[model samples]
Target: MNFLYEKITFIFDPLHHFWEHEKLSRKISIMLVLFFVLSLLAIEAKRLGILTGPLFSFVPTNHFYAISAAFTVVLILEVISLVFTLPCSFSRSVGKQFEILSLILLRNAFKELSKFPEPLTFHGNQEAVLRILSDGFGALLVFGLLGCYYLVQTKAAEKAMRPTDLYAFVAAKKGIALTLLGIFIYMGLHSLTATLAGREHTDFLHQFYTVLILTDILLVLISQCFQPSFYAVFRNSGFALSTLIIRIALAAPPYYNVLLGLAAAIFAILLTLTSSRLFGKK
Candidate 1:
């Protein structure tokens, strides 16, 4: 019975500890590969104007639809994640904390996504902003749970792990938190900016966008005192950068664009450093 109990804990430990034993370069490289492939599809869709929905493929339409579809897809994935994660989270032998916790997490997330301010006004947007926020809310909750899981995993490790490996567990939990937080900010910002611009945003929209993003990034960098994981999380993914590129390629602006690009680059680099360090790479 004791042996069975220990084995169950190992499954969770291994997931968190894998980050420590696994090499940094390899993990990032793999993540990047997945990033690149997904990015390529996104870029290609934009280039070919296929992102606006295949049924509307023949007609040249708008960007809002594309954003909506993408955001919807992301939300669906989180919902699916909840289905798998709930059992792992709350269903305790007697108490079932994971299952209960998971339900609360999912509910809060959905509420954020679907529920907007009262006197709900669509500033000419179809529904993308609300969709993104609702799904985003759930994702954040799940991420919070992930942090909890990591911490629990750490305690589990203490039971069977070397004394020295304890710090490794802490590091991994912190790393995951920082990394996920950054992603949350980046995507949330992206959705907000685009929503503000709407479909009929005039010329110099990118310039305004560049300023907003740069300011946000700079603020985060300064606030965090340049923490590596903090920087790495927000700054890690180049998707937002890609979105900016697509806009610029559509003739947004290049000179001022570079200024904004600099901010994004700094954000990605710093956050990656933070995450890598937290993963025990430091």
Candidate 2:
């Protein structure tokens, strides 16, 4: 177990460093801008009969689709960031999940925009407009609630019986985080292959959220091995439940998706507040 843990750490550290590098982030930002502009140009070209292929079939010829594509890429980056957060404290990881949830809601709002005509008239797009409002405001509400959640968060780490125990706990979480990163890359490649093959690809983020639900449970169990206090268990388990609710929110329809997301956020905030007040050391 110790050897495996060391190997996982050895591999994860450099990958994590590369991901967090300033140069890579700048390049990714530049690539995203280029992708957005190229998407718009591609769509216009297809519309004007300048581009033709089966690959272009799925690409909608709408200015708003470019925006949606850009948002989707941004959301993908956020999810990757969330994966890295798993090695942190459970509370911090949960906070990262909430951040991704808000971005997903915002992406949904922009996705609805793709349904509108190029000129973007409001006349026939009432339902789409309503969806946009629902998802947009839902994101804002979660964003605001996330602030409150963080405000109530205590910065102190949970105590272990020994320093070595704390070190082992972190090592275990790093292993789990590395495993999740592998699964993430596999799922991403699988989804991309399906899309390219003209197969019906699943919603990549939604599928990953299902995996994340199981991962949260695993995290709770692993955490118990090091910190078995009632308060610690309850807090971590409650956060797992919050993640489950977020998974459901992702699967829900538009208006109700927003509602469920808000419910999940409120539940998390309440859980944090209650746990802190009741469990804090005097």
TM-score of 1: 0.23
How well is each residue in 210-263 modelled by candidate 1, as lDDT tens digits? Answer: 443443343334323323353333432332342343234224232233333333
**Per-residue lDDT tens digits of candidate 2, residues 1-282?**
778767877887898899999999999999999999999998889889887788767766787889888988898898899888888888899889999999999999999887888687999999999999999999999999999888888643354468777667777888888888889889999988887778897788889999999999999998888878888888899999998999999999988888888888889888877776766662
Question: How much does each candidate deviate from the true structure in C-alpha RMSD?
Answer: 18.8, 1.5
The lowest-lDDT stretch of 10 consecutive residues in candidate 2 is: 152-161
Cα-lDDT of candidate 1: 0.37
Residue 188's lDDT in candidate 2:
90
True lDDT of residue 98, candidate 2? 92
Which candidate has the top score in TM-score?
A: 2
For all candidates, the clash counts are 19, 0
Lowest lDDT block of 10, candidate 1: 86-95
